[model samples]
Target: MNKPWSESWFDAYAPERFEAFTPSHVWAVLGLIVCALLLWLTRGVIRSHKSVSEGIRWFLMAVLFLSEVTLNIWYVTQRIWDAQTSLPLELCSVTLLLSILMLFFRSRWLYPIILFAGIGGALQAVLTPNLAYAFPHYRFIHFFVAHSGIILAALYMTWIEGLKPTWKSVGGAMLFLNGLALIVWIVDTALGANYMFLAGKPSTPSILDVLGAYPAYILAEEVIALLFFSLMMLLFEVLPGGRLYARSGTYKKTY
Candidate 1:
């Protein structure tokens, strides 16, 4: 009664309906913690080795770009490539694109937006993933790689490259996110797609569940996002040498 690997891989639309915060979830959380620790530990090496650092950045960018393309291809192969759902309109999807751009071009204007969105959006996605798939599934792998890549990129820029965010940068990120949300709302209305969950909350339990009902929850999310952004800023203040690194102008030319 053994199923083919592909059958097992794509089967059940998710993993046996596992509950949240299960063993797999615990492992996923541990993985993120390990990643953060590794990144912090390697910050010195990344800063000291310029060419190597750039190579690592480029490699991460390529991984992100290719992972996204592969996801689209998988959807097509599965015959599930719906225009409404497959488009890169989700906040994390948009974050991936911006993360790539930030890596390639090192745009100063995008620093805070990527920082805020990457941690705010991608970190949350990793923690409370909307994914149904579990380990060894392509969907599960792709979901983690894509979201984790955003966080890594943001950290690389801040810790290694020394791009710092100001209070004004926080405002900029809020404005950019809300403005993009407005456009997505229009698109969601037109196509009846729930990109960004603007149409409604997801069927699965999520942070949205505790936020409140539909439209009201959307507003609450905005407030929550702002709070998260402020907290990320505070993180820099508390980290050892973070403020000094931010004040340093060594990498200003790149930005």
Candidate 2:
């Protein structure tokens, strides 16, 4: 006997566990690639048409917002809403919120951080999701959708809105991330939570697996963040006629 579609979708304690690099993972990655390709293909239309761009922006905002809301609803309904773990305090969750604000207000200050940290963090989450639920589960869908929305939001701002980040923006993003991490660390201490993996690394294998132990891995992340943000700048800025665009006022400040 098989579960009805509705039962499986809403089952909070989904028995299926996500395995990394499985066929399901490959399909999920393919889906994200298709989404990115579609966005790239429509860059011109989105850029030229304000109505279409704003519609996409609002739609993304709603999707990201609902992703978070419905997850919390499921947690509460299932009686598993632990403050220690259920709160939206993880790095990707924070990035999801920033992505929503970035789309909603089109904040230039928020753009650089989202472009670098938002995309970087969300991409990592998509690649090696630290999630429990497998495909077709609501949490599975919510996890991928929320993370994908973060990456899409940043890319839309960059490709469609022509928001270009400078070298200074790399450092700014690092500062913003570290500051937020510090705050999360404090909250983790107060609540005995492991938000952001600040108190410890994830139980599952992750990029941190190779970074070293505990506090040392935390230090390694600081160095990696700087390098990662710089590389992001190089790809988005330097490789894309950055100097010429700057001189030509094509990369004009939004604010």
Candidate 3:
């Protein structure tokens, strides 16, 4: 990113960089198209009345989880560190889709909080974009698409799968996200990549900033997670259909 000469966001980039459509732009577009196609196909699979085994659904989710992890590594860690920050773009879409599909087949227990985070965060992120405009590259496309996918997945899980949130579910979500945050922080230190912007060189303000300071952000997230999780449970639990059935239970969760 070029210095704005002033402090403004729009004047930061040179005209050519934004105007020029290069090979990378084309490749990124193609990648996004492929992801869209796959998501569309997965929706069809989910809608089909075929009864796939619970074990099979769990296994599919596991595969998606691992694949998304690997993609994140390649996309960020593999590249030279840049101050421009962004959410991990790799397999977020696949991860959200699989989470929904798995919740539909078997809520097990943790599905509802996942739905909450996926939906709530996506909704907020979409309405209030972090960047002023299409960034260094045209990353808005990927960011919008992937985050929106999470919302879609969460909606399907809640409305169609009837996933519900419990206290245990909320706790699990916090633990999992914080654990991942620690890992990303450590990895960013080692790899010299700002994967989670934990290195204190982020281009834009992160959720951590709004929540609080270093460790405080983690605690703040827990409190917010607890509160939001409760709201999500209330909303989904009272849906017209018995959507709560696809979840673990209709128990009300408290922090």
Q: Largest TM-score belongs to which candidate?
A: 2
Candidate 3 Cα deviation (angstroms), residue 108: 4.7
Question: Model 2, 1-255: lDDT tens per residue?
Answer: 667877877787667877888887888888888999999898887777889988988989999999888888998888999999998899888988888888888887898888888888888888888888788788888888888888889888877777787777777899999999989999999999999999999987689999999989999988988888888766755565676544553346332
What TM-score goes with each of the models?
Answer: 0.90, 0.93, 0.53
Off by over 4 Å in 3: 1-110, 132-137, 205-210, 240-255
The all-Cα superposition gives candidate 1 an RMSD in Å to the true structure of 2.7
> Each prediction's Cα lDDT score?
0.82, 0.84, 0.50
The model with the greatest lDDT is 2
What's the CA error at residue 117 for candidate 2, in Å?
0.9
lDDT winner, 2 or 3: 2
- Greater TM-score among 1 and 3 belongs to 1
Model 3 global lDDT (CA atoms, 0 to 1):
0.50
Rank by lDDT (best first): 2, 1, 3
Model 1 vs. true fold: TM: 0.90
Instruction: Compose the digit string of candidate 3's lDDT tens values, residues 40-142.
Output: 4564455454363234344445544544454455356547324433344212342465465555555545465456656555555554445433544334444
Score residue 207 of candidate 3 by CA lDDT.
Answer: 58
